[model samples]
Target chain A: AQSVAQPEDQVNVAEGNPLTVKCTYSVSGNPYLFWYVQYPNRGLQFLLKYITGDNLVKGSYGFEAEFNKSQTSFHLKKPSALVSDSALYFCAAEPRTGANNLFFGTGTRLTVIP
Target chain B: SAVISQKPSRDICQRGTSLTIQCQVDSQVTMMFWYRQQPGQSLTLIATANQGSEATYESGFVIDKFPISRPNLTFSTLTVSNMSPEDSSIYLCSGAGGPSYEQYFGPGTRLTVT
Candidate 1:
């Protein structure tokens, strides 16, 4: 079955420091990878995606993800972290050739210490 | 990208009662999906609804239990039938279209069954 994994269940970073949320995928073929963030008591917000272009994909809210095919990883990253950036992050992937169904990871909760 | 909205952002229902959540997209989309997120868990796709066709349900989900209606391109509804405490979750709707392969989600409907 196709799936994505977030090794870390929770990540803590000091404000103004760089933050990284790791993700890796296991799929049959080239897959479409995406990142989403959900705030408490709110819905999900699309962060970014890597379809078929540059490996490094930029997305909303100053968030970006590096798609490494060799390692089968698409890690979400930010140059600097803010208290507002603390949320639950999810990594998802879909097979490029089949239906547009997405498989999501178990999510990582990021906390930015002020 | 298309903007999506869902009605009844949160609801509390008694066991054995049902709730219908509506998802509306600002623009037409090719595919719309229904997903369930249990507390502190990842998303699990319930079904995929396309305009002019019966919804394709994923494994472990049956049409009779969770009926879906895709009346048009811009709107869809998911009805959770005979709800139970186990059905208490956040039901999310997502639309996949546009040039990018990424999907956009609505503010989700939180269902609490007691």
Candidate 2:
């Protein structure tokens, strides 16, 4: 089984401060990790993915994530937060073997306060 | 990356009625997946659809309740039967390209059963 966990239900950050949304995973084999953002009444937009290469992966909208194999974590990060970056963030993982369907976390709501 | 579109972006239906959501991909894809996201929650995989084969559903989801069709490589449909308030959720369709397991998603169908 492949599963991801997002401990925080919501995160609040000041407009110019750095922000981090935590994610952890458990999988049968190697994991393919992904981050997606969903705005109000819209579909999910892909952010970034960690497959096999560098642990640090940069994504759109000045967002990035660091994949730590030992910690079994892939935490999304932003150098500086913006009010427009507020949205729902989801972390998903797929096992290298077996099924290709992704298992997603419960999601984290990010609020950037101006 | 493949572009996916879903029809009837949002709908309100009466209880016991059924609604079928269609997903179309710009290019051919080998696998299509359906997912559901409840209000303020994460996503759950409903089923996996492949052309020329019966859809594979995840646990707690039955084929009778959520019938799926993958008649071709570029299109699929998911029908929600005997709709109830509990079934009110945003349904999303995603497609995976050739060798890359990265999945791209549609805008999602917001189904509200009243």
Candidate 3:
């Protein structure tokens, strides 16, 4: 079984300050990890993914996530947070081989204070 | 990445009614999936919509409650049957395949069962 865990239910960051949403994975093997953002009354928007090479993965909306294998973590980060960045964030993972359906985390609500 | 679109962006239905949400992809995709998100919660995978075959449902989901159809590679539908207040949620459709392994999600259909 594969799963992802988001330790924080909510994260607050001031605008122009750095933000981080933590996530950890428990998979049998190397997993494909993903980040998604959802605003109120809207669907999820793909942020970034970590598949194979490069521990640092850059994604849309000036966001990035570092894939730390030793820590079994993929933490989403932004150098400067914006009020527009406030949304619900989800971390997901799937086995690299079979069953491409992603197992999602419980989600973390990010609030960027203006 | 494929562009995905969904119909009936939001709707309100009475108990015991059924709602069918449509999903269309701009390009061909190997995989399509249905997911549900309750208010202030994370996403949960409903099933994998296989093109030309029955959908593979996740552990707490059943085919009778959420029948899915993928007649081709570019389109799919998920029908929420016999709805109640507990059925109120945002239903999302996603597709994966193309050059990227990451999945693209539609804007989603918000269903409110009264």
Candidate 4:
């Protein structure tokens, strides 16, 4: 079975400060990881994904995530968070060798303080 | 990446009623999926709507409760039947490519059952 774990329920970051939302996963082999954002009363927006190759991957809205294979973690990061970045973040894991099954973590709420 | 859209951005209905949410994709897709998200939880896969077959529902989800239709390669609909307060949540539609392997999500439909 494949699953993802997000240790934090909420993360608070000051505007212009760096932000990190932690995520980890348990899958059989190399996993395809993804990050998504959701605003209140809205649907999820794709943030980024890590399939292979580079350890660090950059994505939309100046967001990036580091895929650490040894740690089984892919933590989302941003050098400078904005108030607009405050939203719910979700991490997902998909088996690269499967028929496209994506298992998502229980979301993390991000609050960028002014 | 493909653009996805969902209809009935939101709807409020009394108990025992049913509501159908429509999803449209700008480009042709092979795999279209439906998901459900509770107030603060991550998304759960509801069903996989193939272009010309019965939807493959996940555990604890049934076709009777959530009927799905995939009339073609770019359009799908999901109907939540016999709604109750527990059914109140955000419904999202996603389309993923076979070769590019990127998943695109729709804005989602917010359903409130009273």
- Tell me how each candidate scores on DockQ against the true complex: 0.65, 0.65, 0.60, 0.57
Question: Candidate 1 — which residues are off by over 4 angstroms?
Answer: B98-100
- Residues B50-100 of candidate 4 have per-residue lDDT tens digits of 788899998999999999999999999999999999999999999988622
Off by over 4 Å in 4: none
- For the predicted complex of model 3, DockQ is 0.60
Candidate 4 lDDT over residue span A1-114, tens digit each: 678999999899999999999999998788789998888877778899998899999999999999999999999999999999999999988886645658899999999999
lDDT of 1 by residue, A69-113 (tens): 999999999999999999999999888765999989999999999
2 or 4, greater by TM-score:
2
Question: What is the lDDT, from 0 to 100, of the residue A114 in candidate 1?
Answer: 100
> B1-29 in candidate 3: lDDT tens per residue?
78899999999999999999999999999
Cα lDDT tens digits, model 3, A1-114, are: 677999999999999999999999998688889999988777788999998899999999999999999999999999999999999999999886667888899999999999
lDDT of 1 at B103: 86
Q: With candidate 1 superimposed using the best TM-score fit, by how many Å does residue B49's alpha carbon deviate from the native?
A: 0.9
Which CAPRI category fits model 4?
medium
User: What proportion of the real contacts between chains A and B does each prediction keep?
Assistant: 0.70, 0.62, 0.66, 0.49
Score candidate 1 by TM-score against the native: 0.96
Model 2 chain A TM-score equals: 0.96
